[model samples]
Target: MNTAINSRIPVALTIAGSDSGGGAGIQADLRTFAFHCVHGTSAITCVTAQNTLGVRRVDAMPMEAVVAQIQAVVEDIGVQAAKTGMLLNQEIIFAVAQQVEALQINNLVVDPVMVSRTGAQLIDDDAVKTLCHTLIPKAVIITPNRYEAQILSGLQINSLEDMQAAAEIIHKTLRTKAVLVKGGGMQGDLRGVDIWFDGDKLEVLTTKQVETKNTHGTGCTLSAAIAANLAKGKDLWQAVQQAKEYVTTALTYALDIGEGQGPVGHFFPLWGLGTGDWELGKKQGSREQGAG
Candidate 1:
């Protein structure tokens, strides 16, 4: 809203699908980054006919075009951090992964978005191989909701124990830096716990559940917010914490827009009293843990 004052916001890149409903995918990433005063760059992998409730259809961009978008930005203005979501096909996945490597980008956040909340699968089963092999290994953080973690690691996740087990399986098998196995899918009375497994130790973050149906784009927002904090120089643990806190606050202040699940007000800090700068909790002379 105040473009003049925020002209030179720090840059973050998001490679994902286009959400026509503006509740998820590229739109949510951009809004989340802008909320943190980070300039957002996007490489739209596909276009989806989607709303708060569900996805009606999805049309993917060609591999050539997807590669071109990443090249067009990363090679030009450059980026401090990047996040990926909803890479529909294998071609686009390979292209984006190669570009991230070729561009030598760091602090990359990967949200393995396979299906929509409404049960429409966005990614092909074949693409899963390419995504796990090509992209997962290079990412600084991987945010996989319960279903996604199960899919990636081939582990049955029914509890926090299962989430922790799956996180290790993913990390050891893929060799990615850190994995955040989101506990949003955990069963039973103890649910709001999200597990972030660094290489050596596991960090458990829990919050009270906000009983709202307006939780669309939560995964995308969390991963993008982590990338934004990484761009702002927070290490992996701090960034993850910052992202979790932001998501909780956003969910608490949800606008309840749209007929189905609504979008979080990523601009909460701008319009309301948002939790601010948790990475300010960082101690002096801190460092990241081996690229996570």
Candidate 2:
């Protein structure tokens, strides 16, 4: 890599876990960042043995290890924006929050991966608490699914109005700069809707709902895309808007590879056009010409 060219490229960091399934977590975040033309870096918080069926086991990295990775990346490469996902436990969450403050990471996107879209709590109560009190406040914006919004805002999200209220409550109570209440876990017409609040203005964002079960990395991809856009110098509102659009388009091309739920195509544009496919197609064409 040319040092001068590499230095000029926009860089984004993801402090998250590694999904061996290659669907979500660090994998999804890095792919999303690359799709947006941002150089992606990561500090893995945990490792998971999982597939599309579900996670079988999880092993969290020590708090010190997580911090060391963050320091290594931030001190040298210097990310323009960063995002956090699946910090596993309270220790790691607290440690990451400290690093964020110590490193002065201003353009931070928090994906609050405490609760799943299906209403299952992934992290323990203490971990969630730490994320709320320690990490979230330092974020430029937080992307919370419906269940996470309910946990953070102390409200039930049954309708669009409830999502709006939850976004506002999270912004005010959590002291974050902005809140995005994701509606992917919602039912019926509200499923793909989202509410945004920035302590100044509120907006209800709606996009064409792409019907697909392969939505494994939707949340991770969305947050990563936002960070990527931020790394590219877009403002908060623009970043969120573009990220949502990118996710929606990616969902339309969601990969259906696994036995269960698959992941959104982070590089949808390159679908069926990988180097291997290109070579194979070229060889086949040459064979057909010889036959002719």
Candidate 3:
């Protein structure tokens, strides 16, 4: 139990890149932590000039700087849970794996951000190889979207069985404790069904797919939410379930700020107008109780 003496706040660390648009990467991770009421720390791996449209330029951080940031946070603050995203190259991936191994960060979630929806490879082959050999093995759980899972497992996922097969291959090949093959990119009814495999048990987690284009930071948000829930002492399955719920709600109230794909509403509970009857009832109750 990582209980800070004075604060006792659960802490989650995100080792990822920075999205200048504040829609994905470290920005999304921090927003998710805040939503879960957890303390968030970050060690940025790269800096990206990106928006809802697309990534324009990406500058990978030096291995030394990335490692130093991780060490600085871990040595003092001490993370209860940690996650990795957007490791742009082999050097960063290798350095991060070494540090995670050295510090023995147990509750680790790996989000393999390798490819875009258009089937374009985002990182180099060497980086993917490094992630396969090093980073994935250290993760307690790995969250890979359909494309990433396909890349990792070398299995095309066209159906539920295919998704499960891919998850199994990823688990066996990468040696992670658990694997979630997200099905959001799938077409038709298969869209929101995510497949989870944890060696012994295979589970299908499902949610209603929101009919919105404002889903830019969803992957980062979901992984960070899982890490946050883990930091809060939830079991592995419970953390994934909670994270799924959180993401569903965020999608339901997704933002419409950008011209392209906008960000999910991370602060929806704080900002969104409640459902009509519920809001009215709450107001009435508050008035009766002489509050608000």
Candidate 4:
């Protein structure tokens, strides 16, 4: 590795859960940050035993410990931007929000991790209020998948119009500054689209969805990648565009890593490119980088 290009490592923080299987959560966030050449730090709020199949169990981290981690990072190394995932309870949500407000952090991307792709409940039922009232206002941008967006906004989204309507409402009501509604669950033949509502403008972003099982951690990776780009000073839309490109490439090279579903080849870029390592698909998966 050449040290010449390694100037100041732009710092980004992820306040999310831990996935022992490494498909999603902090593990995936770290890999995505490294791919974009940003230094990553984390404040883990829950621990889980999971794989490509689904999350089997979750134990929320103690609020005190979570507080300690956030304090340590913001007070020491100082993050350029931050994002969050899977907050299990009300107390934890409030805990994270307080610290974020105190620090007045910028470029905060919130990935409301409510449910798993396998339909497992990752967030607690009782904490929805706390999440909206506290976390939403603190975030610079909120990235929610179709279901998660629906739940967070209390809107039934089945069409593009509905998604745009709900995104604007959520943005205004929550005062989140911006709401990015991801249409990965769009009906019938339409390419999956993600909409971003930044108070003034509504941008709908689309990418052809590949029919593959390697989509684990995509939401987390997208938000983290956006935060990483923002850490490097890209504006909101530019960050989202770059993040979308990264996910597209990652998904194009899906990894058959687990017994049940599978994870996207996080390091899939290095194989076809030759000089670098498709660190995940090559070192960790049977699939090749450009195989998709």
- lDDT of each model, Cα atoms only? 0.81, 0.89, 0.88, 0.81
For model 1, what is the C-alpha lDDT against the true structure?
A: 0.81
Number of residue pairs clashing in candidate 4, backbone atoms closer than 3 angstroms, sequence gap of 3 or more or interchain: 0
> What does the lDDT read for residue 16 in candidate 1?
93
**Model 1, residue 227: what's the lDDT?**
97
TM-score of each: 0.87, 0.92, 0.91, 0.89
Q: By summed lDDT, which 10 consecutive residues of candidate 4 come out lowest?
A: 283-292
Clashes of each: 0, 0, 0, 0
Error of 1 at 83 (Å): 0.5
The deviation in Å at residue 126 for candidate 3 is 0.8
State the lDDT of candidate 4 residue by residue for 154-204, as single tens digits. Answer: 888878888998898889888987888876656665445888899899888
Whole-model lDDT, candidate 4?
0.81
The CA-based lDDT of model 2 is what?
0.89
Cα RMSD, each candidate: 8.5, 6.3, 5.7, 4.4
Candidate 2 displacement at residue 283 in angstroms? 24
Candidate 1 — worst ten consecutive residues by lDDT sum?
A: 283-292
Tens digit of per-residue lDDT, candidate 2, span 1-292: 1112246789899999999999999999999999988999999999999999999999999999999999888887788999999999999999999999888887999999999888889999989889999999999999999999999999988999999999999999999999999999999999999999999999999998777788899999999999999999999999999999999877876767779998876876674564576444334333522211
